[model samples]
Target: SFMVRPFSLGLRLFVAMTAGHILLKVLAGFVVNAGSAGLGVGLLVGIPSFGLMVGISALELLVAGIQAYVFALLTSLYLNDAVNLH
Candidate 1:
């Protein structure tokens, strides 16, 4: 139970950090692919995709901060447990 807690937290943080990056890359690919298709199609598809990427980028920034805070909080909690252990 004790070990699982930290492991799960780390796993969750890892997945959260990576998933955003992966989605951003996919969106960027869509923009690039659409641009090569044609000007009209490019404007239609690339604009929204690029906009989405921008929004995702901002969200990713926030997630990063939250992740850092969670990590520090967990680490402190773990240390406190270690110190108080019987």
Candidate 2:
């Protein structure tokens, strides 16, 4: 259980971070492709893609912080348990 808990936490964090990055990369590709498609299409697709990228970036930051906090809290709890073992 001890090893499984941290492993699951790490896997969740890894997936969250990787998914956000992959999404941003795909959105960036859309923006670049839209640019070559001309101004109208660029405005139509690029703007929304850019906006979504920004929003996702912000969300990624929040998720990273929250995950880090959770990881630290769990680590401390484990340490406490080991130290106070009777």
Candidate 3:
């Protein structure tokens, strides 16, 4: 149980980070495509897409920190559980 807990925790963090990065990449591609369409089209679609990417990037940064903290906290908690169990 103890070993499985940590494995699962790491897996969850990995999945979350991977998914966030993938979404960011997709959004970035949209921004690039929109910008290349033409000046007028670029201004309309690219501006909003770029803004959304900025917001998502900020959120991802926050999530990354939070995930680190959570992983550390969970590790400590698991350690505590192991110590107390014995």
Best by TM-score: 1
lDDT of 1: 0.92
* Model 1 lDDT tens row, 1-86: 67787888889898998899999999999999998999999999999999999999999999999999999999898878877985
Which residue pairs of candidate 2 clash?
none
Give one digit per residue, the lDDT tens place, for model 3 in 1-86.
Answer: 98899889989999999988998898888889987899998888888888988998999999999999999999999999999997
lDDT of each: 0.92, 0.89, 0.91
Candidate 2: residue 57 Cα off by (Å): 1.0
Off by over 4 Å in 2: 82-86
Write the residue-wise lDDT of candidate 2 on 40-60 in tens digits. Answer: 989999999999999999998
> Which residue pairs show collisions in model 1?
none
> Candidates' TM-scores?
0.90, 0.84, 0.87
Candidate 3 lDDT score at position 72: 93
lDDT score, candidate 1, position 46: 97
Residue ranges of candidate 1 with Cα displaced over 4 Å? none
List candidate 3 segments past 4 Å from native. Answer: none
TM-score computed on alpha carbons, candidate 3: 0.87
With candidate 1 superimposed using the best TM-score fit, by how many Å does residue 73's alpha carbon deviate from the native?
Answer: 0.6
